[model samples]
Target: MSLAHPAHTPDMINIMIVGDSISHGSSGDWTWRYRFWKHLREHGSNIDLVGPKDTLDNIRTAEVGDDDATYADPEFDPDHDAQWGRPYLTEKDEIEAKVREHEPDYLLVLLGINDLFWYGVEPPQFEANLREFVACARRANPGLTIVLGTVLPCRKAVDDPDFGARVDACNNRLRAVAEDLDTPSSPLAVAETAAEFIATEHTWDGTHPNPNGELRIAAAFADALADRFGIGARYPRPYPDVPPVALDAKASID
Candidate 1:
């Protein structure tokens, strides 16, 4: 039931987004994952965004509730494996269980910022953790397609010179890891987000992306999916600052 083809397909592809604050997003803000969802819907792709948790970091907890604080978008399935301030090593076991439960066709991973910045995990250790994380997912689902995202640049890199080098080291190792893990049944690719998401314009506080940044991030994933797996349409940038006029909106008869 994989829609990893070009032609008009009716099958639905299950996708799971896994990361930290960058993926979890805020209460009012739309994450890159959300933008990707919109892109898939617009392109007439049958897909389900799957995850165990459905709560934004700044908005709500993962607990069930009836109030507005409980949901980011009640209509949309806000399920994801994003936990604020937590590294992949901290939640590798939980992520494995999630992969087994959801059985997603694709796993979009955008992590490592916290691991390098907060935890001060060196490049070697970070790569090891990343390798273990991918292994966990593959063990859960042998046919799963894993797309790893490069660690985005941050303003902190200016203050901490070693931070940038560490990020680069991790990304270099990540590319190698992808090459090592790719197979015919299960493929691995890297979504280049670091270059697209500049710390100045794309991010609000040198870390989290604003709306424009979100779109760019989404475009990166979309491009990767379309180019590498042929799963979805590629989304171009220059996203509108204001909402477009509704085609069906009615005007009073004059």
Candidate 2:
């Protein structure tokens, strides 16, 4: 589990983002993943974002975009393992393969929302699936660092009396899962997404985040990375805006 060896170079860190829509991002939206990439670039960190998929969700066409969104610097790698509607169960099977393919130093997980909102997965079962997903990643590479994120509150949860409570219960179990999985060589840390992502302020439509919300999410992950792994540099606020770039006509999600 110890990565302090010749296998991993000290200069470069490979990070893989793992999640559903929140991580995949929709067309014309800058995902929290991009924000985190900008944070790394601004701080002069030698990091590479790795994944099998490199396309953004096209909310307009109800398909993958033909071109990548111009949310951050074009130089930043946009690769990640996020899918549009994938749940923990779906990701559990795919995670090991992704780990083997990307060989990332860290996996930043922001899943479970779809499981609860879309699939109606219970909190306990969701937590179990999450644990298995983590185990899959570890089995692929014991030295991999795992950062788990608490689910953000949604506007729809306010209307559904039990939804909000379910989210809270799942978050609590998420923390416990992190604590149970923490090891010196392959440590698990929980990023407080719920605190940073306010349903009213950060999200555009209660589910996905607006641009400002994306920054908050990035800040949360960046702070956790700095605090736990000592990998990221200080992120400056009022992040410079990168104008949207035109997508290629042939660009499509694979």
Candidate 3:
């Protein structure tokens, strides 16, 4: 479907999503981000994608249960295949440096699962850190829009029952923070995927999602931006039935 507003050309919008492994496409076939990108391209839009090259400073261990532990000790357990290091941009300085360089038009930040998995940071610290990330990015480019991606629901590890709940809490706090960041007349807005994505069975593992999940995520963010900023949509709103020319299950995704 075409955008509802006056049609925009390819250069009208440029998006850059930043975060941990999720932003890096470790979830599924990186479908979420790619799907969003594909929609824009099909509609004759140009998008500039920016993210890290590798899995830097992401959660390295799987929690068997909610009570498994608070933060994995920063030590490599070769037998268990667990690493002792930290996730990338664990500090604000690193993120600030990167934003100054890229200066993207729209910045999508998806993080904190590693913090939950590793350091067991509570809602307060997580919000504070996320706020810092957002503030710094906005400071670097005043007109830049920000979309905060949420942690996907995870199947309980044999050891963790509260893993999913903790993620919920994180999302809740993020929503509050995003709202607080907005003014009645401000241009900054929030995009949420917690509801749209978690129910789908497209996850690569029980935790990370596959390509379909990614597409949903991208579409959700694009829709959010269109609603809030009046930016033309990348995907056709009021989506219709699949076309015969559409990609097959495997080929479409690839």
Q: Largest TM-score belongs to which candidate?
A: 2
Write one digit per residue (lDDT tens) for candidate 3, span 44-114. Answer: 55555543332222222253211112111112110110122223237454656566675557776666677
| Residue 162's lDDT in candidate 3 | 78
Please give the CA lDDT of all the candidate structures: 0.76, 0.79, 0.54
Error of 3 at 110 (Å): 1.5
**For each candidate, what TM-score against the reference?**
0.84, 0.86, 0.68
lDDT of 1 by residue, 12-109 (tens): 78889998888887555666777788787788767788787766653333532211222223455567777677687676667778898987889999
Candidate with the larger TM-score of 1 and 2: 2
Question: Quick one: best lDDT, which candidate?
Answer: 2
Q: Per-residue lDDT for 153-192 in model 2, tens only?
A: 8897777879999999999999999999899999999888
Candidate 2 regions with alpha-carbon error over 4 angstroms: 1-10, 64-73, 234-254
The reply for model 3, stretches above 4 Å from the true place, is: 1-12, 26-30, 51-91, 157-161, 183-186, 234-254
Residue-level error in angstroms, candidate 3, position 149: 1.5
